[model samples]
Target: MKDAHSNRVLLLSLLIGFIVVSLFVLGVRTLVPPDEGRYAEMAREMFASGDWITTRLNGIKYFEKPPLQTWMNALSFTLFGVGDWQARLWTGLCGIIGVLLTGYAGARVYGPRVGLYAALVLGSSFYWVACSQINSLDMGLSGMMTIALCALLVAQRDSATPTEQRNWMLLCWAGMALAVLSKGLIGLVLPGGVLVFYTLAARDWQIWTRLHLGKGLLLFFAIAAPWFVLVGLQNPEQPHFFFIHEHFDRFLLKEHKREAAWWIFLALLAAGCVPWLGVLVQSLLQSLRRTPGAAQERFRPGLLLLVWVVFIIAFFTKSSSKLPGYILPVFPAVALMIAHYLETASRRSRSVNAALLVLLGAAFLGFVPFMLRLAKRAGEDLLYQQYQPWVLAAGIVALAGGVLALVFDRRLQRDRAVIALALGGFFATHLILAGFEPIGQARAGVGMVPAIRAEIMPTSTIYAVGLYEQSLTFYLGRPVVLVDYLDEFSFGLQQQPALAIPTVDAFVVQWRAHAAAGVRDIAITRDDIVAQLKKDGVPVRIVAADARRIVIANF
Candidate 1:
C-alpha cells in the first residue's frame, strides 16, 4: 500500500511536470504564418467586435471553417489578454486534456501502468507537441474527437455497469457535438463511422442495442445544432457554402487546392512515431488478436483503436483535400496501444527498443549537414545556422534518454526506463521547435511589425498589395485593405465587396485620394508592387522592407 501510494504521488508529479513543460513551450516562439496568424486575428476580431457567433477575418465575414476554435480563442483573449501564448491557450489546454484523458482511460480499461505510459507517450509525441502549441483548428478537433472515442470505449466495456455505461455514452455524445463544433462533420462522422465499421467487421450486431441512440441523438443535437442553425439563419450563404462547398466539395474535389497522395498519411505516421515505431507496430499487431471467447462477449479496445486508425487513414486517403495534421486523431490510439505493449515488454525487448531509439537519435545528427545545404540553396542559410545547435541538442538529449533507459532496464527498473525515453522525446520536440523559431520569426513577418506600428494613426488605411502575410494584421492591431489579392479571404470579400480594393490601379487611386484628403495610408506589398508603383510614376515612400514584403506609404 505504501509503494502504491508512492507511485501515485510520483505519477502526479510527472503529470504536473508535463503541464508545466507544455505551458513553457507554448510561449517559446512567435505565432507562425497562414494558420496561426489567421486564427489569432480572427479571435482578435471577434473580441474587438463582441460578436461571438459570427467569425470574421480582417473585418470581413470569413467562413472557411467553423467558429468554435475562434470562439475559444476570443474567450482566451478575454480572459488572458491577447499575445502569442494567450492565442494558443485553448488548443494547448485541449491537448493537455487529451493526454490526461488517454492516460486515465487506458488505466481504467487496462491497468495503472498502461495508463501512465500512454499519457507519457502521447505527451512526448513529435507531431502532437507541435500541433498542440499552435493555434490550429485540427488539434482542438482531434482532442474533442479523442474524448468522444475514448468515452465510448470506456462506456461500452464489459466491466461497466449499466448506469456507468449510459453516463459514459452520453459523455461520448457530448464530445461528438463539441467535435462537430471544432471542425465540422468529421468529428461525429469519423467516430460513428468507425463504430459502424467495427460492428460490421466484428459481426457484433448486438452492440447497436447498447448505443442509446435516442437520448444520445438528443444530446448531440442539443450541443451541435444551435450554432449551425443560428449561423445559417444569420448568413443565408452559410448553409450552402459550409455544408456543400466546405464539406462536400473539399472532400470530393480539389477546389480548395490542398491535395496529397493517398500514401501521404502513412508516411506521416511513420515519421510521427519515430522513436517508438518498432514497438508501436508490434503492439498494433498484438491488438489484432482476439480473446478466447465469443466475439460479442469480448470488449476489444485494441480492435477498436485499430479500426479507428485505419478508417481515419482510409477516409482521408479517399478525400481530395489533405494536410499532414488531418491524421492527428490516430496518435492517441497508437499511444495507448504502445503503452500497453511496453507495460508487459520483457527487459530484453525494452533494452533493444532503447538501443533502437539511441540509434535513431544519433542518425538524426548525420542529416544536419544535408539539411543545412538545402537551406543554403533556399536562401535560408542564416535560419538554418541558428537551427543547427538546437537540433544537435535535441539529438544529444534523445541519445542520452536511450542510454538512461538502457541503464534503468539493466537495473530491472523498467518503468523508469520508459519514463526516461518519454521525457527525452518530449524535450527533443521542444528543442526542435525552439530551433525553428528563427525560421518562424523570419517567415512570420514579425520584424516588420514595429515599422508598421510606428506609422499608425486613427484615420490611416493599410493595404496589402499582391500578397497577404496573415500575421501582419494581428500585430498592427487593425485590418489592412487588401489590394489586388484574394485568397482565403475571398469568401469574406464576396460577402462585403466594399472591404477590398479590387485592383492595384484602384488602390493607387484610393492612395491619391487619401493623400489629397491629408490622410496617411500604408501599403504592405512585395518588391514587384514597388516596381509597378515606381513605373506608374506614383509618389511612394518606403516605410519598411523585409525579405518577403515591404510597407510603403503614399504621401
Candidate 2:
C-alpha cells in the first residue's frame, strides 16, 4: 500500500513538472513564421483595429481559419500585452487543460494510476507539447477535441449516474462546438464520424439512445453558430469559401499542393511518440480486445479509443491537404491506450522501453552534424552551429533518462521508470524548441525590427513589396501596403483590390510619387526587387536588411 501511495505521488510530481516546464518554455523562443507569426499577427491586428467582426492580416482579410485561436489570442493580448509569450498563451492553456481533461477521464473510466500515466504521456508528447507553445490553431482544436473525447469517455461509462451522463454529454457537445470554432468543420466531422463508426463496428446501436442528441445539438449550435452567422451575414462569400473551398475542395483536390503518401501519418506517429513509440503498436493491438473490467458495459472505452485514433488518421490520410499538425488530435487517444498498457506491462517490456530511449537519444546525437548541414538558406549556417549544443544536450538528457528508467525498471519500480523516461522525453523536446530560437530570430526578422520601428512615422506608409513577413508586421504594431505579394491572402485580396498594388510597375510609380512629395514610406522586399528598383532609378534608401528581405524607404 505504501509503495502504491509513493508511486501515485511520484506520478503527480512528474505531471506537475511537465506542466511547469511547458509554461516556462512558452516565453523561451521567438515565434516561427507562416503559422505562429501569421496567427499572432491576426490577433494583434484584430486587437489593435478593434474590429473583431472581420479578421485581417497585414490589413487584408484573412479567412483561411476560423477565429477561435485568434479570438483567444486577442483576448490574451487585451489582458496582457502584445508579445511572443502573449501570442502563445491561448495554445499553452489549451494544452495544459487537455492534459488535465485526459487525466480526469482516464481516472473515471480506467483507474487512477492509468489516468496519471495518460496525462503524463499526452503532456510530454512532442506534437502536443510543441504545438502548445506555438501560436497556432492545431493545439487549440486538439485541445477542444480532447475535451469532447474525455467528456464522452467519462459520461458514457456504466459507472456514470443519470445526472452525470446528461451534464457530461452537454459538455461534450460544447467542446465540439468550440473545436469547430478552432479550425473548421472537421472539429465536428471527425468526432461525429468516430461516433458513427464506433456504433457500426461495436454493433451497439442502442448506445445512440443514451447520447441526449437533441439537447446536445442545441448546445453545439448555440456555441458554434453566432460567429458563423455574423461572419457570413457580413461577408456573403465566406459560406462558400469556408465550407466548400476550405473543407470539401481542400480535401478532394491537389490545389493545396500538400499531398503526401497515404503512409505519411504512420511515419509521423512513430516519430512524434518518441520514447513511448516502443509500446505504441502493442497498445493498439491490445485495444482490439475488450478490457478486463469493461465486458459488462455496453460502451467500451478501449474500443472507442481505437476507433478515435483510427478514424482521425484515416480521415486525414484520405485528404489531399496533408500536414504534420493534421495528425495531432489523435495523440491523446493514443496516450490513453498506451497508458492502459503501461499500467500492467511486464518488467521485460518496461526494460525494453528504457533501452529504446537510450538508443533514440544516442541516435539523435549522431544526427547533429547532418542537422547543422541542413541550413538551406544563406547565412543560416551560423545559426545551425549555435543550435548544435542544445541538440547535444537534449541527446544527453535522453541518455540520462534511459539510464534512470533502466535502473528503476530493474528495481521493479514501474512508475519511477515511466516518470524518468517521460521527464527526459519532455525536456528533450523543450531543449530543441529553445535551441531553435536563433533560427526563429532570423526567420522572424528580429534584428531589423528595431531599425524599421525607428523609421516609422504616424503618416508613413509601410509596403510589403513582393513579400510579407508576418512576424515583422506584428512586432511593428502596424499594417503594410501589399505591393504585388498575394499568396494565402489572394482570396482576401480578390475582394479588396484597393488594399494592394497589383504590380511592381504600379508600385514603382507610387514610390516615385511618394518620394517626390517628400513623404517617408517603408517597403519590405526581396534583394532582386531592390536591385530592380535601383536599376529602374526609383528612389529607395535601404534602412535595414536580413537574409530573406530588405527594408527600404522613400525619404
Candidate 3:
C-alpha cells in the first residue's frame, strides 16, 4: 500500500508537470524586444541559403555570434514550416528537457518529493519561461550546462562503482562539448570553476581520481574541436575577431561599451527569481546552518550551486556587455537548492511555510498595479494594443493563484499545501506568459512587415540607414543595403560599396536629384524632413508610421 501510494504521487506529479509545460508551450512565438526576432530571422535565411559557414543579418556578414543557434533553427525550419513556432521550438524543447533533468537529478540524489518540487520551481521560473520561448542561445546553453552538472553529480555519488563513474564522467565531457557548441568557453569554465572551488573547499581529493581526466579530455576534443577547426579553416580571418575581440575583450575591457555597476546584477537576480525570492533567501540561510557532517555530505552540491550562481553573476557583472539572459544557467542551481530546503523542512515548520505563502501572495498582488503603471508610463494604449489583454490576463491569473495558495494553506497540512500552492501559482503564471505574451509581440512585428513590403520596390534597394532590423530583413527575404552611422558599419560599407551611402548629406542630395529626374513616387513618414522636402518642391507620399519606426521608399 505504501509503494502504491508512492507510485500514485509520482504519477500525479508527472501529470501536473505535463499540463503546466504543455500550457506554457502552447501558442508560443519567437517575438521579443531584441534577440528573438533577430536570431529567428537569421535562422530562416540559413535554411533558405543552405550555407552554414557564415551568418548573415540584413544580408551582411554577421560574425557577431556563432552559428550553432542558427543551425538549430534552420534544422527546425526544414522539418516544420518557416514560422515563429518553428523558430522557437528548439529553445522551448531544451527548456522542458532541462526541467526534467533537474527533477530526475533531485529524485536520484534526494527523494521523489524533492524531484517534483525542483522540476516545478525550475519550469515556472520567470527567467526560464521567458528565455525558453525565444530564439536566443542562452536557454539552450543553460540546458546543456545543466546536463553536464547532473552527470558530474551522478558520477560523484557513484564513485564506489568505477565503471558507472566512468560512464557518467564521459557524459559530463560530452555535455560540455555541446555546451561549447551552444555558447562558448564559458560553458566549460563556469562549471569547471564550480567543481574546483567545491573540491578545494571540501578537501575532497578523491574527486580527481573519479574524473578520468585523460579520456574525458579526448572525448571533449573529439566532439567540439572538429566544428571549430572546419569553420575556422573556411574563414581564416574569423579567429582573432571571434576569440579575442568578441569573447575576451568584450568581457574584460568593456569593448562593447555596455557597462553597468555590479549591484545592478544583484538587483536583476532578485527580480529574475520573482515571487520565490522570499523562499530562496530562506533556503540559503538554512543551508548555511547545517551541521559539519551533514554539511560535508551535502556541501558539494550546495557549494556547487552557490559557485554557479556567484561566478555567473560576478563574471557578467564585471563584463562590458550584459543581458538578463546571460545568467540563465544559474537558475537550475537555484531551483535545486529551493527544492532541497522544502523537502528537508519538518512537518512542524508550519510557520515558515505560512510566512512564505503570505509573502508570495503579496508580491503577486503588487505586480498587477505596477504593470499597469508601466504600461501608462510607456505611452501604450493598453486596450488597443495587442499585448494588453495577455498582460492583464497574466496579472489576473497570478493574483488568483496567489489567493488560492493562501486560502488552501489554512485548510491542509502546511508543508504539502504550501508546496502545492507555490507550484500551482507558477504553473498559471508560466502558462499565461508562454501561451499569450510572446504571440502578441510576434504578431505586432508580423503586422508591420506588410507595410514595409508595400513601400519597397522589388528592384529598388532596401537599406537600414542606422540599424539592422533582423525581423524585417527575414520577412523581406533579401540582403539589405546599409548606410553608414558608426565605425564597424562604416568599415563594412567600405568593403561593399553597393550597400554604403557616403554621408547623410550626400544621400539626401542624391535623393533630391533622383526625384527631379522623374522619380515621382517617394514614400516617407509625416516628419519635418518630409515637410521640408515638400516645401522644396519635391513630391513625397506618406507610407507608414508607428510609435517605433517609419517606413519610407523612393521610386
Candidate topping lDDT: 2
RMSD of 1: 1.9
**Residue 284 lDDT, candidate 3, scale 0-100:** 66
Model 2, poorest ten-residue lDDT window?
A: 1-10
lDDT of 1 by residue, 1-555 (tens): 233213868877888898998987787888888889999999999999998878888898987788889999999899989889988988999899999999888888887878888888888888888789988998999999889978988897889999988999999999999999999999889998999989887777877888889999999999999988998889988888788888899999998788987799999987787567658678888778774463655577888889999999999999999998899999999998898888777888788878987987897788676666756334588788888889888889889999999999898887788888888888888899888998888778888888877886888988999888787778777888888888887788888999998998888888889988989888889888899889998878999876788889887
Give RMSD to native, each candidate. 1.9, 1.5, 3.8
Residue 14's C-alpha lDDT in candidate 1?
Answer: 89
Q: Which ranges in model 2 have alpha carbons more than 4 Å from their true place?
A: 1-12
The Cα error of candidate 1 at residue 209, in Å, is 1.3
TM-score for each candidate, following the candidate numbering: 0.96, 0.97, 0.86
Indicate the TM-score of model 3.
0.86
Write model 2 residue lDDT over 1-555, tens digit each, in one string: 244324657656766776788787899888888788899999998998898878888888888789999999999999999888999989999999998898888888888888878887887777777888888888899999999999999989988999999999999999999999999999999999999999998888987888899999999999999999999989998888899989999999999899999999999998888778888998999988887765677888888999999999999999989999999899889999999999999988888878999998898799898886888888899999999999999999998998999999998888778878888888888898999999999999988988988987887899999888888888788788898888898899999989999999999898889889878889999999999899988898999987889999998
lDDT of each: 0.86, 0.89, 0.66
Off by over 4 Å in 1: 1-6, 292-296, 369-371, 376-379
Model with the higher TM-score, candidate 1 or 2: 2
- Which pairs clash in model 3? none
Better of 1 and 3 by TM-score: 1
C-alpha lDDT of candidate 1 relative to the true structure? 0.86
